[model samples]
Structure formats: C-alpha cells, structure tokens
Target chain A: MSSTTVDDRSTTVTPPKTRGAGRLKDGRQRSPVAMVVMLLLVLLWITPTLGLLVTSFRTRDAAATSGWWEALWAGGWTTTNYSRVIEQADLGTAFLNGILVAVPATIIPIMFAAFAAYAFTFMDFKGKDVLFIVIVAVMVVPIQAAFQPLLDVLGPRGLGISGQYLAVWLLHTGFGMPLCIYILRNYMSSLPFSIVESARIDGCSNFQIFWKLIAPMSMPAIAAFATLQFLWVWNDLLIAKLFLTNDNTTVIVKLQQLLGTQGQGAELLTAGAFISIVLPMIVFFVLQNFLVRGMTSGAVKG
Target chain B: MTYSHSTPPVGGETAVDESDPRVDDASPEATVPSDYGLQPVKLLIGVLGVAATLWVMMNLFLAFAYHPEWFFDSKILMGTLGLVVGVGGAAVLFWFINVAIEALPRKLEHGLVPYAFLIPGFSLMALTLFYPTIQSIHYSFANRDSTEYVGLQNYRELFSEGAFWSAVLNNVLWIAIVPAVTVALGVVVAVLADKLSASSEKWAKSFIFMPMAISFVAASAIWLTTIYAYQPPGAAQTGALNAIVQQFGGTPQSWLSIDTARLNSLLLMVILVWLQTGFAMVLLSSAIKGVPEDTIEAARIDGASEWQIFWQVIIPQILGTIITVFITVVILVLKVFDIVYVLTNGRDNTNVIANMFFNEMFARGQAGRATAIVVILLIAVIPILIFQVKQFREQEATR
Candidate 1:
C-alpha cells in the first residue's frame, strides 16, 4: 500500500551534510526526463492493441488497403462484423455453457479445498505429511497425461458418464484441488492458533468451526482463487473439446468454429475474440483488488 | 448429600471448574474409563447397517422394477455403483472421519485431525494421478500394440527416428527463443508501464494484458486470419500486415507460408510470444514495483546514468522473479500444441513434441509412438522440475 517515490532531481544533486538537502537537490532535476520516457513506453505498449481495435472496426476492404492508423483519416467503420459473428456463431449458447461449467468448477474446489486446508493446518492425524505431499506432487503431472485416463473413467467401461456437465466439472475440480489446497493450507496455517483452540474449548464442532470461523477468515484467498479458476475455465478450449460436445461447447470453442479452414470469413473472428475476452476482463476488474492481494499473499514464499 | 446449597437461576453466571468430574463426565461411573471395545463395535455396526440398507434397497428395486432393463445391464449397474461407492462413499468416509476426529480426547485431537481431512484428497489423487503415471511408465516399455513384450525397442526407435530428433531440436529452439524473448519483452513493457502517468499507464497495461485473456485457439485464429493467406487480389488483404505491405506498393505475401529456411515456423513462435508477453509482463511488473525506490535514487545521486541504474539497480533486484517467469514460460513453450494445431496443423516445420504426439496418437493411430513421445516429453521436463523445486526451497528459506 505504501508508494515510494524516487527523487527526480537526484541526478543533479551532490552529497550534502543532511539527508533533506541531498533529497531537495535531486527532486528538482529528474522529473521531466522520467515523464518523457514513461510516455514513450506507454505509447509503445498501446500501439498493437490499438491496431487490433481499429482493424476490428473498419471494413475488410479498407482494413486490407490501409494500415490501422489510416482508418483515423478514412473515417469509415461499421458493426457488420459483430452482427455476422452473432448470427453465424452460436455465441449465446456457448457463453451460457461456459458459465455453467466455470461457476460450479470454481465453487466446488474452493469449498473442498477450504475444509481440507483447515484440517491440514489445524487438525493432526496419522499419515498427514505423506498425504499432503502426495496432493502437492499431483501438481507436477500435466493435464494431458490425465486426458486419456480420465476419458477411460468417464467412458462406457467405467463411470459411463460421457458428454455431460458433470464430467468436465469433476475433471476441473480434481485438477484444481491440489493448488487450491496448497495455497489455502499455507494461508490458514498462518492464522492465530489461539483463536482456534479457544473455539474448540467452547465445544464448537469441526464443521461449525470451519463454517463460522475459517471460511469467514479466508474470504480474500477464496476470492483470489475464484478469479483465477474462472479465467482459466472460461478461456479453456481443449478440455471443452474433449468432454463437451455439440450444444455443450464453450465460447472459446464457438470462436474456433467461426473460423473456417482458410479463415475466409475471419474478419468476424476479431469480434468473436473480443466477445470471449469481455467476461474475463469484467471478472478481473471486479476482483482486481482481491486479485492483487491474493497474488502477494499466495506467492507462497517461493 | 442430605442438604444442598440454593441453586442459581437458569442462565445466571456460574463459573465451571476446570477439573470438575461430576459435571463434565460422560460415564455412569465417573472414575472409570468407558469400554474401548464398544467404540469399534459401534463403528462396525454403523458401517454394516448402511451397507445392508443399500443392498435391500437395490434388491427391492430389481424385484419390482419398472425399468428392469436398467438393473440387468452391467454398464448401468457399474455406473450407479461407481457413483454411489466412489464419490458418495468418499463423502461418507470423510464425514465419518470428521466426526471421529471431534470425538477424540483433547490431548489426542491435534495428532489425528489433519490425517482425517487428508485421507479423501490423497486417495482420489492416488487413484486418478499417481496410478496413471505409473501405468504410463509401464506402457512405455511395452510393444507398439501393447500386446507383447518389446523391451528397449520403443526407446531405441525414439532415439533413432529423424522426426523424433527434429521434434527435439524444435523443442530446443522453442525453449531457447520463446522464454527468452517473452521475458525480455515483458521486462521492457513492465518497466515502461511503471514509468507512465496514471491514465496512460492503465491503457498500456490493459493493452499488453489483453492477449492473456484470449484462448490459445482464438488467438491462433486471429493470427491465422491476419498473417496467413487470405488475399483475394483486387479485393485487398484482410490481414493487417499484408494490407500494410500492399499499401506500400509491395506484393501481398502469405507470411505463414514464407518457408525461407524455417522463417515461417519462427513466425508461429511470434504468436506465442505475443500471447505470453502479458503473463511475463504482469509478473515482472510486480517485481519491478517491488524494487526499493531509495536504491534508484541513491544510484542517480551517485552520478549513475539512467541505463546504469536500470542495469545495476533494477535488474539485479528482480533477477529471481525473472528466473521464475522464465521457467514458467519454458514449461508453456514445451507443451506448445494448441497454436501449432490450430494455425498450421504442424506443417511447414512447425511441429513440436506435443503436436507430434497428437498426430501420432489420433491422426496416425500409432498409440505406441504417441505414448513414446509423451514419455520423452515427461523425461525432458524432469530436470526443469528439479531446478524449480530447488528454487522454491531457496525462496522458502529466505521468506
């Protein structure tokens, strides 16, 4: 929360008898050059996104005929691409499916993880160290490795739970639980143990203790994980392709479908891409403070 | 026992003694321990009671079933059983353990509570992850069809194949180029954005971070439309780059098709760099922000130039974060598939290990070779994993 501003005039200042005299001389000399360089850097970073935005607005012919910068002078833009994308792609259904999968996927793991994290941090039991390590080690295994095995389980021979929302939801929860537990456990362990002991002595059951005490305290971490998991599931394409079929496809999958083999009608792609990006942007903005807090909190000392 | 003191009204404040046996005791005989045998006997009875109830319910359904076919079908039986037993059973067991943990005496609770919570997660992880990983290793040594024993043959073929070597080399190029470029660009952008004024800073950071939100498939689609062949001659190019070229009176060219000695493949790498730059930027930006302002001011006061301050003061302080970002990017680049799969379908020298695995498994129907590729990729990642673990420990110690 603290902002540390460097002295701008430090370059022109010589060492003085006092710290105040030294800071005063440096504060005056360095501000202008810093401002100019910062402005240039900002411009460089903004150019590409500006180009993408401008190209999305202009007609295909005008876009191809001139640089995105030229669109400023040409002054012709339309929403035809957006309309075409909406009409051609099943954007609505895909977006709904994305929400259906992402919301539960985010919530379930956080729920399971919080309880497990509490137990790991506060409770003592046999084989606790080995169990915790096993969970942590699962993080190293790539999702691709599990794809076949998961399909085998979901397919006809095993659970026979193919092509349903539950399949993808379970897969996401399973994959997400390890890191969620790891972060939540670390955070929960750092809380004051005296409070927990007092609650136990007051005859509070474990579930009651978790629901009333631990959950309220870990809201910041839970919110942080929710933002991350939501973004990941929303942008995910492979798992959706693998598990969800036809009407169950997510927005990202729908965007992929919009682009033909040669990407011929793909000027529509820019609009579709933007549509898919909108929700995540909103989520990030809404939870921006918690997101920053969680990152710093959960960077896990490592 | 004959005479008692007047009792306080209900809800009146009363101090309870810490070692009061008569009030706190659960046993009929307050001085004696309850029979320990009764505990396990009750647990056994509860478990059997639930199992018996499930059995009777299943039989009754079968006996008077409207959907008799469902009961007869093995698949249905197995599915129902798996759901009830696998997921539901786990939930039940978790609940039982949670209850038992609370019942433990205060002195023993600390030692038993964590294990009770961990049992379910560990069991599921073992069943789904650890078991499969071991299965994969076993599968690696088997024959292509996995029908017969063929020890070392797959490993031999893996080492000798030209395509395998090409995939390895491409992976090397990817590891070298993607992470290095992404980190460098990310650092530059992060530093620049940090220097910007408030309004411009938001706009710049948002622009750089935009690609991070796009799916790999969507981003690839965007690039494919923009850079690949979409020219219709007199109609003008829809791709922004080729359009710019045409405006300058140069002929429009398919940038992705330019196989001027693997330049096309490198162009594919560019899309990845663009997509990942935001990730690197965000991490490094925070790292840069964490640099102590006093250090920079002190350097400037000591006659250090702007370049000198950046190189000496800022970079050194953030080197650990830079390494973290670098390793993350490397892992991503190693698993690079979606872009190559979507953009060019691994043509024009763009194929990496992952795409090759997918091609062999799904496209070519060579499960043996596909599994082989996966095993090789896993092995390659091991050294990186070890390094990451070491870094993690070091960081933990400092914290």
Candidate 2:
C-alpha cells in the first residue's frame, strides 16, 4: 500500500510539467568560474596519483633529483622500473597470489548469497524478515573484531585454517555476505510476480522456480556483485595480510611488505606499487557499468 | 566508489521492475511437477545431499588443514583446483539440498526449507563473525593468554593510559576533521563538476575519483612521495610538499613523523580525505543530478544567483546523500588501519583504535587489551549503523 501510494503520488507531478519543458539536461548553462573551480578541484584531487604515476617510470637518479612534474619535462624513463619490480622484487609472485586469493574469494560470497537470496525472495519462510534484517546489519560489524578470535580458532589450535587460501576465502565470504545477500534479494524479488505466480500455479517446485526461473534472470545483478566483490577482495590488504600471512599472498600486501623491508631505494616503491595497481585499474574500466549497479544496490565497498 | 558511470547515474537501481519483460502466458517449465510422491526417491535425495554436503565441507576443511601440500605444494595448482572443486562441489551441495528440501512432506517442508537455505550463510556468519565476535568480548575481559580472567582490569588499564588516550584523541581528530572536510569538498566538487560541459566532465570526475580504486598501501606510497618523503640536510627534496616548502625557503620537516604541530596526524587525515573525496564526489554528484529539474529552474526564475540556487535548491534535495556519504566515511575512519600501519605503524603518537588493536594483539600479544580496542571500535560503529539501516528501510518502503 505504501508503495502504491508513493507511485500514485509521483505520477500526478510528472507528466504536465514534462509536457511544458524538455528534460532538465537539455537546458544548458556554462560559466567560466564553475569550469575553473572544477579544474582546480580535479587537479588537487589527482595530483598525488599523477605525481606517483610519473615517478613510477622515472629512474632513481631522476626521481631523486626532482619532483615528478619536473622530471617529466627533464626526460628520463625506463622499462626496467616495471620489470625490475616484477623480476627482482617478487611482485610477479605477489601478482599471481593476488589472482589466486581473489578468484575464489570473489566466487564464494556470490554463490552462497545467491542461493540464500532465492529463498528469501520466493520461499514462504517464517522469521525471514528478522533473519534478513539481522544479516543486513551484520554488514556494519567491524571485521576487525573477528580477527583475534579467528586467529585463535584457526591458528593451528582449533581448525588450523590460518594463512591458507581457504582462510582468506572463507573470511571474505563472511565479510561479503550481509551486503551481497541484501543486494541480490532486492534484485531477485523485483522479478515480475506474474511469472512466479504462473510457475507456482502450474506446480513448479521452489527449487525448480529458483534454478529455472530466477537464476538466469539474476545474472546482471550477479555480474555486478561479482565485479565489485573481486575488486574489494583484490584491493583489500588488511584482511589478506592477516589471513594469508605467508610470503606468497596478495600483490597489495606484498607491496606493503616491500615498503616495509625495502624502505630504502624509494623509487622501487613507485614501480612496485603500480604493478599492484594496474590490474584493478583494468577491472574498474571493464566492469564500469556494474559499479553503478553496485553502489545503488547497497554496500559501499570502502 | 570510483566507478560513477558517465551519465548522471542514480535512481534507476531502486526501481528494478521498470524494464521487466512480460513472460508468455504459458511457459513449458511451469507445466511439470504437480504431484508429491515417491517416498523412496525423496529419502534417496535427502541422504545423498547430507552425504555430499559432508564430503564437500570435509574437502574444504582438509584442503585448508593440509594446505601447501593438498595440491602438491604449488600456489597456482592450489588456486586452480581450489576454485574448481570449491565452486563445483558447493554448487552440487547447494543443488542437492535445495532439491532435498523441496521434496520434503508438506507438514515439515515449510518450517525446514528456510533454515536449510539459511544454514550455510548463517553458520558462516556465526563461525566467522558472531562466534569470533563473542570470543573477542570474552577475551577482552581475560588476561594476555586468555587463560586468566582479569575482569575489568584490561578495560581499566586501557582507560587509564595516556598512549591509549592519545590514540583515542587522534581518532577523535580524524573523525572530526576527515568527514566534514571530505564531505564539503565532495559536495563543492560535485556541484562544480556538474556545471562542466558534457565532454570533459566525466574525465574531471574520473581524475578526482582515481584514488578510490587503488589500495591504501599504494596510496601511502604515493603520499609518501608527494608529501612525506623526508631527506637529511643538503639532500634534494623529492617530495612535492617539501619541494614547494623549499621553494619558499622553508624546511622539509618529516611531515609524517613530526608532532610539533600535530602535523603527522593531520597529514594522515589528508591521505584519508584524499582517498575518500572521490567516493563522496561520485555519490554526491549523482545525488546532485537526482535533484528535481523544476526546483532549480524555479529558483533561477525567482531571481536567485548561482550560489543561492546551489545552496537553496540542490543542497536540501541531496542532504540525505551527504549524510550517507558522511557516515560511510566515519565508519572507514574508525577502521583506519592500513594507512597508519603502512606509513608510521602508529609511531610518533599517531595511533588510532584499529592500529592499537593490531599493536596489542599481534605486536604485543595482549589479547585482552586488543579485544577492548575492538570493542571500542564496534561501539563507535553502532549508532552510525542504526542510521544506515533506517535510511535503507525508508528507501525500501518508497520502492
């Protein structure tokens, strides 16, 4: 009833106004002050990243002698900056480890959340609302709380899952669940009631309706969810560093390790950090559309 | 947060039925499965599911228990096989149980089905989140090894110490400064960027939003180069801030280590503000676009200037989004671990709650004190969480 009331109220205010004026975007106003202000903001925002990017390619002497902007005009670049980190700094191994941890970490949450979402949407289960509410609120539980107990439980004492890929994967799944299930259920439940009603009227079982009817329909949401989760797990350093404590874990964690032990030769950090950064940059561009879906869908990945 | 699409992209996500294609009147898959019969078949399905689930969970357990050797001690091999078997095996397990639950007799199916679907997810949260969370609380009240019950001594000790108080003070400074400044910058940038010509607007926003996608550790490295890389006297300053400082005949004080002016904590806050502003921008930019067209036009028609229109019309409409962005950043600020750990390891009086938690547990082996820090972090998070949940529910009701 609230939904219907909201819908009815919106229709009354839209049509007459739209008929008189074109959409707001069609009307354009440009001001030089606004443009300059925007440019300044953009510059301020991107200065650190741009400076780092240029420094990543510069040789040690060039980087040390001048700032990145100055070095750009002063001319000196090397391909070895990239390869040296990969070959010598063990970034290549770290990169592979990132992929290894990220792939399964990404998949586990999406699948578990999907099946559970199907139940939440289509099945007539008691305590469903309460359960969903509790789980959704679990999104805010500082996973920092989980670390010590998790370490103790899994730390060769209880389950012996610490430092393994499985440890990270399972932890990621748990961390990802509240938001993933919330997004997925919201997406799935929006399917036309007519299709589901017809399926039920024809006596299709709940699982049949979920698999044959709901799963395919939910692919876009799944893809959107997966892309965000993959990036979250990939770029995450804290959780991976804790769980995958071994030398070969994630590129970002390894990059931090590089920063720690190899504090000298600061130019190496620029290249090593970029090596860790490049893949996520690609993912951001490739799955660009889903990110909008991800944001409004819920769970802002920080 | 980095990925705000080119268009003024918001609002379509909340309303999901907008483009639903109508199904044909009679679909073929809907035609079968009227009768609930074959008791033997049902029993077989249930038994198979239970056995297979145990097998799958067992494999997962053994895989972790004997890791580095489970797949012949190779990372690549372990990664590949773990994905295949984990995914394939989980799929089979989920499918079997889903079927087994559906085939149960009418009397118990309704009660059991929800729990069946819920068991894996619930148990995971219980195992990984709730169980650990409870243990953390218990450990907070216990001694270093957690073998001795120290009661409130850890909390008393934590409450009394100046180092702990400084961490709290720095965190307070962070939450106070970072959210307000980041939100103001985001709002201003969003409004200004919204005024840009279509061709370059996205690029301008993308440039600002770039840091959101990178890891904080990498951001630390970048910021170290940009602002914090300190050199001894007579050394050429490579850091941008120091280079500029030297240009004006000032010194390149180690910006990260100096507490003379509380510069180090403020510098750390700037890194957060830098990382978070883009997220705030993208979300607030979309929320700006979502402001009704007629409202701003009406303000302009009423002889309002650009600034008046922005403040009067746009800000009111998107205040909810600003609050949402603010709370999100607050939560992030509370969990501020990676940056502090990577850059200074909370040295020079730059510690926050999360960094303190790590310092106590892993670095110092003080479980009770560590859990207290964690509990402190959780207490800080709860009010903001309640606000977020209320926001979500209100949004849902409108849908």
Candidate 3:
C-alpha cells in the first residue's frame, strides 16, 4: 500500500541503519488511484446482480421505461411478481420438490464418500491406490457422459427406475462421489493419527473408529461437501431435465420454464430467480469458509 | 507410503494441529494379523444373519420408493420416509456386521473391518458412477435410439456437422476468453485489495465474491434483463445498455441477438466471466496472503520498486495458484450450459457443446449423438485430468 512519494528525500535522510519499515506507505495500494480502480471494478462486477435486485421490486412499467438507477428516485414498487411466482406459477411446489431433490442428493453422497474416504485414508486395503486413482480421475468426467448410460440403465430393461426421484437421487449419489471422496480423503488424512491409534489401542474396532471417531472428527470436511453438493443439486438443471419428467420439475427447471416467449415474464422470472437463489445464498454465506476449503482441497493444490 | 498431511492449502490458513502423526503406534495387538475365516457353523450363521438383514432392508426401501399412493402420493413424503428407512437401515446393517465380527475370533476382526467400512460406499459408486460410465461409452457406438450398433457413424456425423463445429468453435472461444480475462482481473483485484487496509479488503472482496453464490440460471436472468435485454426500435428500451445508448442519442440495439463479429457469444461470455471472477479472486486473494511478507519487505528495503517486487517476487510465488484457478475455471467453462440454455438457448451463434448435446438428446431424441458428444467432452477433459493428477503427485512428493 506504500503511498508516500518514493523517498525523494533520500539524499536528506538516509538513516544510520536500514529500517525495514520505510516511510513509503506500500505504494501498490495506499494510493487513491488503487482504491478508485478496485472499487470501480468491484462496482462493475456486481452491477448486474444489483440491477436485478432493484428491477425486481419496481413495477413492470417502471422497469421498462427507465433503468434501475432511475427507479430509485422515482419510487415505484410491487410485490405482485413475487406473489405470482409463489401462487400462480407453483414455485412453492417446485421449492418443495427442490428440497426433495437436494436433501438426499446431498446426504447420500456425503455419507457414502465419508465411508470411502475413511477406509482409503486410515485403513489398508487391496488395490487401494489404483482404485483411489481411478475414482479421482473420474472427477473430471463431466456430468454429460453419465446421462446417456444412466438413461439406458434406468430404462425398462435395465432397472425400470426412470422418472423416479430415487433414480435422480442415485445418479447424483454416483456423480458426486469422486469430488466428495477426494475432499473427504484429504481432510481425513490431515486429522491427528494419534487419535486413531489411541482409539485402536483402547480396543475400538475399525468400523467403530470410522463411525465414532473419523466421521465426527471430519465434520468440517463433511460440512464443506454438504454445502457444495446442496448448492449444486439445488442449482442443477441438466441432471433434472435428463432424469425427471415434466411432472417432477424442481425449482430450477421451473424457473427456466417460466422464461416465456423472449423472457416475457421478466418480472416473474426475475423474482423467481431470486426465490431459487435465496436458499443457496444463505447456505453459502453461512458455510463459505468450508466451501472455500472443500473447493480448494478437491480441485486446487497448494 | 506415508499419507500427506497439512500441506498448507490455499485458503486453509490454519494447518491441522498435529505434532506427531501416526508413526507412534507401538501396541503389540495392532501388529498381529489373522487370516479371515470363521468356523463353518459361525460363518453360516453370520452369512444368513447379514443376508436376512439386507433382504429386509431392501424390501423396506422398495416399499417406501414404490408405494407412494399409500404415502398420500406426495413425493416429499416418499422421499423423506425412504431416506429415513434407507439411512436407518444402513446403520443397522453396519451394526449387525460389527456384532458378527465381534463374535468371530478376536484376531480376525482387524482383517475384515477395512473391507466392511468400504462396502456400502463402494457399492453405491459401483452401481451408479462406475456402471453408468461404462454404459455411456457403449451407447456412443449405437444408433440414435441406441437400439443398434452404428460403429462410429455418430462420431463421424458429429465431427462433420456445421452446427457441431460451431459449438466447438464457440467452446474454444469461450474457454480462451473467459478464464484468461477472469484470472487477469482477479489477480489485479487480489493484489490491489491485499494492499488496502484489512476492513477495506474484506468489503471489496465480498462484493466481488457475491456473484459466486447465485445460480447460473439466475445470473443469466440478471444479465439478460439488466444488460443484454433488447426491444424494437419504437418501444422503450428495457435493457440498461440500450437505454444508456438511447439516452446518449444513439440507437437501441438487441445486444444478445446482434451478429456483427459474434457479439452475442461474447455477451454470453461476460455473464460467465462475472460469475467466475469472484471465485478466482477469493482463491487468489488467499494465495496472495500466503506469499511470505518478509520476502516483499526484503525486496522493498533493497530499493526494489513496487512494480519490480510484484513482478519478480510476488507473481512467481503465486504462479501455482494462478494455474490451479485457471484450470478449475476452464473445466467449468467447458461444460458451460445453464447460461447458454437460459439466456439464448444457444441460438444466434451462441451454441456450445453441452447445449448442443442436450438439444440432440432431448429435443431430437438422438441418444447415440448425445452420448457421442458426451464421450467427446470426456476426452477433452482427460489431458486436464492428467495434469491434475501430476499436480497431486507433486503435492504429495513435496509434502
């Protein structure tokens, strides 16, 4: 942030010995130039989201003729869009369906991945390294690859489970595994080994150690994956469109459907998008630390 | 091989508090191993007992999943009850096996426990992830409805199609622009914000990070209405850009539908850049903090210019992080669907691979074409996967 002029007074005062804390205020950012540039960029980054927030509250007429900046001073608002989304559009039902989709989709993979992560980290098993590598390698396999095969397997001949929430649930369970397992494995291995050793010497079985010790001890990692999976499931459209029928629409697909001819339901769509995002935003702010950790552990390395 | 612990991950500012990891286990019983077998009578009893438990659990799960009519025909009712029974049933199954293992000779318990821990999770993966992956590759070779083996016909047609090539070109354009621009902007913000006071840094970073929490569908709506929205020449402009243009005595333009120089695709790219810049910034900001402060101080005291220190000392220190963020964002951009699907539905030169794949599969009912697209997408990701694995190994080795 050194903002002081780069010591033109150098000839006047060279101090007896070098002081690490120079008079120059870290000029990279201490200057007003840095503050203005960063703030302008930040404002530019959020303008779209902010525009929607403002426009969502304005009346349809007000939103069309003028910008969000103008609507602030003119003072016009309506709750009709929100009401229409909830009552007439059946967004509430879709939200309920979203819960149905997101809950099991989140818990199933996390629990399953936790078990796999525990065994892979704390216990010795055959083909462990090779198996773990294959699983993690598939982490990069985009969700598109799994959809066609899933359709066949869940078809009448394979399992006859299509159009069922259970089918979608199981699809997410499988699809979510590689990343969740990777995150949990990294976190579990970081846990103190002495805890496992002491518990082992105390005559606790490996199953007991995993369930009683590792599962609870890995709560941060577990929470990280849970937040991520929940957001992903809640926000997902591709998986829902491929797996669920029209009768089983989640909130996201419902919002996409609300996009009438050329987004004619701009008001309703705007409010509807808000309704879909509210839950995940709440989850994100509350567990952002874990989200950051889980994301880095799974995708990025030091 | 020893497990890598606490390698000081980006954003994981606090390392695990472990002075001594598990090399200290010296117990004699832990060292003793036993062959895994029970007597015939015990084995028979255990197998039948576990089999009965699994059979009952399966029936219960099926009943909950299938008999929604009895549960008032509510999907929520069926889902909740099924989850309860499924999870409760699983816990009971695990407890049952643990008790059975305890009944066996004590030395044999260790041999079986690890496999026991692995069974449920691995089975789920086997049924869902592992099986579907193999099946998807198989469908890539079949005909449209997947009823016959076409033998590379789908791939041949896909590669030759104009629409397919357009999708690929758009994908390449998006991947080329979005990640590079996002990382460049993100690094600037991260470096600038780091130089600010702590409170200002937090505020500025949070504003940039706000878009990450919203869904892409929602993000598309925000941009579609607020920025890229269009109207007829006579009507009032709803989109902010066109409105501003009109206010400045220019013509209102349909931003997303405009075709001069592929402006529509670039418009779609802006939405992604907006969403991902936040993610890049957060990770890169944490990484900036991880750069040792004393090194910068040394450079400063040695009369190095701020630009010189940033270029020489800071950027090199965080190159690993820049690559990590870039790759993550690239993967996201390659599968970019919701934005295109929501805003333009891949119309007007905005088609990308994922959107094309979805349209071919669902709208056109071409399963073979769809799976072929999926296989292509999977193939595109393999080099990145190899790079990721190499990075992971390097991490392990360095740790």
Q: What does the lDDT read for residue A199 in candidate 1?
A: 67
Encode model 1's per-residue lDDT on B1-399: one tens digit a residue.
011112223333345433433435555432223212124434555456545554653343333222435557333343344334433444445455555553444334445556556655655455556665666666667765456667777778878887778777777888989999999988988877666544455667766666666678767766665455357555556566777777788887767667676677788888889877877887888899899889999999999998999999999999988887887788778878878777766676667888887777656755556667777777877777677566655655674
Interface RMSD of each: 9.2, 9.1, 6.4
lDDT per residue for candidate 3 within B1-399, as digits (tens), equals 332221222333233223323213454432233212233454556567778878986665556446767778878777787677656666766766666775454456555666776787778777776777778889989998889999999999998899899899999999999999999988999988876755677789878887777888888888888887777776677788888888888888878888578899998888888888888988888888889989999999999998999999999999999999999888888999988987788888889999998988888989999989988988899898899878777886785
Can you write out model 2's per-residue Cα lDDT over B247-353, one digit (the tens) per residue? 78887778888886678989988998898888888889888888888998899899999889888888999998888888878877878889999899989999888
Interface RMSD of 2: 9.1
Q: What TM-score is obtained for chain B in each of the predicted models? A: 0.78, 0.88, 0.85
RMSD of each: 8.1, 9.5, 8.1
Instruction: Report the lDDT of model 3 for residue B372.
Output: 92
Indicate which candidate wins on DockQ: 3
**lDDT for model 3:** 0.77
Pull out the clashing pairs in model 2. none
- The two-chain DockQ for each candidate, comma-separated, is 0.23, 0.35, 0.39
lDDT of 2: 0.77
lDDT of 3 by residue, A1-302 (tens): 12123333452465635433432222232556667898899889878877888888887778877677777677678988898879867989888888888898888677667777887888775778777877767776687776777777776667776777777887787778888888999998888887877666555666788888888889999898888788888888888877776667788888888764444677788788889888988888788888877777776311
Quantify all predictions' global Cα lDDT against the true fold.
0.66, 0.77, 0.77
- Model 1 residue B259 lDDT score: 60
